[model samples]
Target: MWTEVNNSLHRKFEFKDFSEAFAFMTRVAMIAEKMDHHPRWTNVSNGHQMFLQTVACKNSIQFINRVFAHSNQ
Candidate 1:
C-alpha cells in the first residue's frame, strides 16, 4: 500500500532480485512518461522505494497502484 508523507505518496517494493526490481522501475517509467508524471525513487538490491508528489495529479496514485500490483508478475 502507498503511504502519504510530506505531501507525497510513498511506497517501498521488494522484488526477487536486482534485475526484477530494475525491470519494474523501467516499466513504471514508461507509464509515467506517458502521463508526464515521474517518480523519485531509490533502488538497492531487490528493494525499490518510490515517492510521487500529490501535486502531480490524482491519477498518479491510481496509476502507481496498477503498476505495483502487476509488478510481481
Candidate 2:
C-alpha cells in the first residue's frame, strides 16, 4: 500500500532477494517509460522503495494513478 507523505506517494516492497528486488525495479522502469514519467526510488538489501510527487500544472489524478499502479505492481 502507498500513503501520501511530504507531497509524494510512497511505497515499499520486499522481495526474496536482491535479484528479485532488482527485477521489480526493472519492471517499474519499463512501465514508467511507457507512461513517460518516472519516480524516485531506492534499493536496500531485499527491499525497494519508491516515491512519486505531484507535478505542477499536471493532472494529479493521473499522476497518482500511474504512481500507485506501478508502485503496487
Best by lDDT: 2
Residue pairs in collision within model 2: none
Evaluated at residue 41, the lDDT of candidate 2 is 90
lDDT of 1 by residue, 15-49 (tens): 99999999988988887777666677999999998
Tens-digit per-residue lDDT, 17-46, candidate 2: 999999988888888788767778999989
Q: Which parts of model 1 are misplaced by more than 4 Å?
A: 54-73
> What are the RMSD figures for all models against the true structure?
4.2, 2.9
Write down the worst ten-residue block by lDDT for model 2.
Answer: 57-66
Off by over 4 Å in 2: 56-71
lDDT of 1: 0.72
* Backbone clash count, each prediction separately: 0, 0
- In terms of lDDT, the poorest run of 10 residues in model 1 is 64-73
Cα deviation of 66, candidate 2, in Å: 4.7
The TM-score obtained by model 1 is 0.73
